[model samples]
Target: MAYLADTYIRFPIKVRNASGVRIWDLDGKEYIDTFMGIGVLLFGHNHPNVIRAMKEKMERYVHLSNFFLDEDAEYVARRLISETGKGGKVFFTNSGAESIECALKVIEKFRKRNRRKGKIVSFVKNFHGRTLGALRITGFERIRIPFIEHDTEVVFLPYNASEVEVFMKAETVDAVFLEVIHGSGGLNMIPGEVVEVIKFYQKKHNFLLVADEVQSGLGRTGKFYGYQHFDLDPDIVTIAKGIGGGLPLGACLMLGELADIFETGEHGSTFAPNPVALAAGRVILQMITAELLEHVTNIGKAFKEIFSQFGTVRGLGLMRGVELEKRVTKEEFLSEGLLVNIVGEKTIRFLLPLNVSNDELDEIAERFSRVLKV
Candidate 1:
C-alpha cells in the first residue's frame, strides 16, 4: 500500500477471490458485489466461457502486431459491427478512454476531410473518459480544470435541457458525443425529447452523433447498444467496459459515411487487438443473447421495485443509481458485506452483472435494505 500510487480511493478490503456475483475478502468474508468491476464484468468475475476462450487463444499464441492478420480480431470486429445493425469499420483500443480518443480523432479527420470547421456538442455531467482529448469534452469541471488548454472548441449543454434546441439550430456542429445513460456522473438516462432534437438536427445539419456506450452497452442496459433504447442512430460509437468480458478491450465503431474517415496511417494501436482479450470479447458478444437481455430487464425491474422504497432510482436495466434521502458512504455498504459504488454522498450506483440471478438480486436487496435502515 505504501509503494502504490494513491490515484484510486482504494477499497478497504483486499479481495481474495470472486465468483459469479460474490467476492471474498482477505479475511474470508464474503460480500455481494454490485459494482461489477465498474461495469466491466458482464458475465461476472472469471466466467467459465470467457476463461476458456482466453486459455484456448493463449495455447495457440498471444501477441501479434496489427500488421499481421488474425482471425479472432477480425471476428470480434465483424461481430461488433454486426451488432450495431449499421455498416461500419472498427478501430480497436485498450480501454474506454482510448476508444474515446479514437472517436475524437475520427471527428477531427471527418471535419477536415469535408472542409468543415464546427464545434462539438457534449452534455453537462456527461462522463466520457479521463484522457486529455476525452477530458476536453468531458463535463466534469474539477478534472478538466487542471488540463484547461484542451484547444478544441466544444459546447457543453445541460443534459436533457431544451437549450440544446437553440444550439442545434444556431451552431455548425461537427459532432455530438452522447451517453444514452450517463455512468459516472450518476446513472442519468437521456430523455426522449433530447434524443429527438439530436436526431432532427442531424438530418438537417449532417453532423455526426457519437454514442459513448462504455458503461451502458453490451447488455448492461438490456440492449446490444444503449442507444437502441432511443430512436437515435449514432454515426460513431465508442465502446468498452463489458465488451472485453472482464478484460481490457474497447472499440470505436464508425458508421455511415464516417466509416472511411481514417486512412492507413491515420490511426492505430499496439495492444488494441490483443488475441487473448478478443477471444474473451468474442464469447461475451455471443453470450449477450435475447434471453440474457430479457433477464437484465427483469432484474432491473426488480431492482427498481426494491430501491424505489429508498429514493429515486435512475437508469435502465442493470445500470441503476439510487438517490437516497439520507447520505450514505461506501464504507457503510462495505460494513454490511456488500460492495457498491458511491457517487458523491447520496447516490449509490449499481452495475450488476447481466447474469445475476433472482436469488442474488433478493440477497442484494436485503443487504441494501439493511444498509439503508442503518
Candidate 2:
C-alpha cells in the first residue's frame, strides 16, 4: 500500500510533535526518548538555539552549493579545528557516510601518492557507515557485503591493545580506521592503551589514523571529540550525527600533511554546507562548552551507578550501552513508554541528549527498572 521503500524496521507510533527529551505520539501517549534520534539530537528536539539559528539562516538563505563560500560553514569549521588544537583543513558533507567517503578517497589517495599499498585496517565489530565505500571497511559483513563489492583491500583486526602492536608492526597498512567508542556495534570501547599503542606505531610505520566520530563525537563522550579520551591524536577525523542539531551535516577533519591532499574539485557534495544547516551546526558547537562536557561526565557516572543495579554498563559519557544479565528488549521499552535500542543479545544503548536534565534521566531509569521487573 505504501510507495516508499521498506528499508527501516517500521514502528507503528506516529510522532506528532517532540520537545526536549519527550516525544508525543498521535494517540497522545508521551514517551521518554532515550535514543535521542539515534544520537542526532544532541540538544534534544526543537532546541531554542538550534531553531533560532535555522530561522535566522532561513530568513537569509537555505541552500548554497560548494561553489560559494558560506560564512556559517567557515565559522563552524574554524571552531572544529580549534577544538582539536590542530591547524587543519575540513571538507563538509551532508552525512557521516559522505564524510567517510571523503576520508576514504583522501586517505587512499594519500597512500597511492606516497607509493604505499592500498590496505586499510579497522577493528572487528566496529561500524563506519552503510555506503559502498564505508561498507568495505566496516567489520560487519553480513549486512551489506552481498549487494556491494570493494576493490580496496581491508583487514579486520581484534580490539586488543597488545595484538594491535603486533598487527601494525607486521602489516603494510595505508590507513587505520578507529571508532574510539563503538556506537552502533554494541557500544564497545577502544581501550586507552590500544590508542597509545596505535599512536606509537602510527609514527613508526607512517600511517594515517582516521577516527570515525560519527556517533561518538560532539560532547557525546564528555569531550568535544571522543578520541580526546585517549592519548592518541588522529590524523583524520570524520564527524556527524550531532553536529547539525538534527539537520543533516558532517565533516572530515584532516591534520598535518594530510590536510591539503584533497585538491580543488577532487571531492565534494552538492547538498553539503547548506546555510541553514551550517548555522544550526555552528550554534551547536558553540553551545558545547567545557561546563556542559563536565556535566555530561557527571551524568554518565550517575546513570552508570543506577544502571549497575540492573546490569553491566559500558561506554563513555552519555553514549553508554547497558548489558543486562537478562537483556532488555526494545519491545519492553516501547511498552513502558521509553525509547531505546536493543543493540545486541543483552545490550540496550543509551544516547541521551547532551543537555538532557538529570530529572529526565532519573525518570527514564525508574521506568527502566519497572520494565525489567516485569
Candidate 3:
C-alpha cells in the first residue's frame, strides 16, 4: 500500500542504512554505492563532519526565516562566490529545481530592465530541473510535452551545433543556459568547440551565460564548477546535489552587474537557507579542498580505465558513464552487490564519492567487472 506519487521508478531493495560508499538493504545485503545518492553525497553517506554540524545546529535551531540575518547561510554563500573568483551574490534554495527557477527569474528581470530581447537558447538533452520555468528550458520533449507552454521563448540547439553562432548573429538573445556536463543526458560533456563558439559570440552580444552545475558542481567533476574545465565565463551558476552532504540545499550565484539584479521583494523561499542544511553545507564546502579535488581527478582516471574495458566511456572526474557492449539491468548489478545508476538502455552512470579511497576503488572495480563477467 504505497501512498507516494508515481513520479519515480524506484529500485526494489529497501535501504536500511548507508555509510560512506556502502549501503545495507533490509535483508542485510551490503552493496557498493556508485550512484552516491544521484551524485549528492560527495563526501559519501553520513559524513562525520556534516552530521556533526547538522546535529550541533539542530540543538540551537532548525529553521530560520528570510527576514533575519543568518551567519551559517552567509558563510556558505561567501564560500560559493569565492570559489567562482567573481564578485557575486547568492540566493539559496531547497533543491536544484528551485535554484534554476531563481536563475530564470533573475535573468528575465535583468534582461527586461536592460531592454534586451527575451528569447533564451538552451541545448538539446540538457536537463535544468523539473519546475515550470526550468522545464521550459529543459531539452527533453517527452517529459516537457505535458507542461511546457507553446509560446515559451527558447531555442533548443544540439550540443555541438554550429547553428548557435548562426542563430545568435541573426537574433538578439537574453540568455543561454548550459549544463557544462550534461548529467541526466547520459553524462555527456559539452564539446570544446561549442564552448568556443558560445564564448566568442557572448563577447560580442553580451548575452548572459548561465552554467547549470546542479549535478556536476562541488567537486563532482574534480573542479569547483564543471564550467571551469573550459575557457568560458558564466554570469549565473546554479548548484546543488553535493553542497548539503545529502540534505536539501541549492544556490543561484549571480555575478557582476547581475549580482544585485533582484529587488527587495522580487523573490524569496520559505524553507531555503535552513539552519541545519546551511551548517552541513558550510562543512561540505570546506571539505572540498585542493587535495580532495586532486584525488577525484586521479581516482576518476582509474575508474575510466576500468569502465573502458566494459565499453565506450564518457565524462570527467567521478561523473562517468559507460555504454556497455551488452545490455544489463539495475537488478543484475544489485545481484553483483553494486548499486549503480542506469541511463537510457545501456549506459551505466558511475558517480563515486569524492573521498573514495584507492582500496575502495579496487573493490568497486572487482565487483563491477564481475557483473559484466570481465
lDDT (Cα atoms) of all candidates against the true structure: 0.88, 0.86, 0.88
The best-first sequence of candidates by TM-score reads 3, 1, 2
Instruction: List ranges where model 2 is wrong by over 4 Å.
Output: 148-152
Clashing pairs in 2: none
> Who is ahead in lDDT, 2 or 3?
3
Per-prediction TM-score to the true structure, in the order listed: 0.97, 0.96, 0.97
Give per-residue CA lDDT, model 1, range 1-374, as digits (tens): 79998779877788999998989998899998899999999989889999999999899988888988778778888988998888999999999999999998988888888899998989888888888889988988888878875656898898654799988878899999998887888888888888888889898999989999999888888888889999678999998988877778999999978788788988998887788899998898889899999999988999898779889999999999999898888888899899888886688899988998888888888888898883
Question: What TM-score would you give candidate 2 relative to the actual structure?
Answer: 0.96
Runs with alpha carbons beyond 4 Å of true place in candidate 3:
none
Candidate 2 C-alpha lDDT tens digits along 1-374: 29888778855689999999999999899998888889999999999999998999999888868779988878899988888888799999889999999898987788779988746898888888888888878878786568565545788888888788887777787889999878778888987778788888788888899999898888998998888888668888998888988889999998878888878788878889878889999899889999999999999999888888888899988989998887566777889899877776888889999987788888998899899982
Model 3 Cα lDDT, one tens digit per residue, 240-261 = 9888878899999999988889
Model 1 residue runs over 4 Å out of place are 149-152
Error of 3 at 336 (Å): 0.9
Q: How many residue pairs clash in each candidate?
A: 0, 0, 0
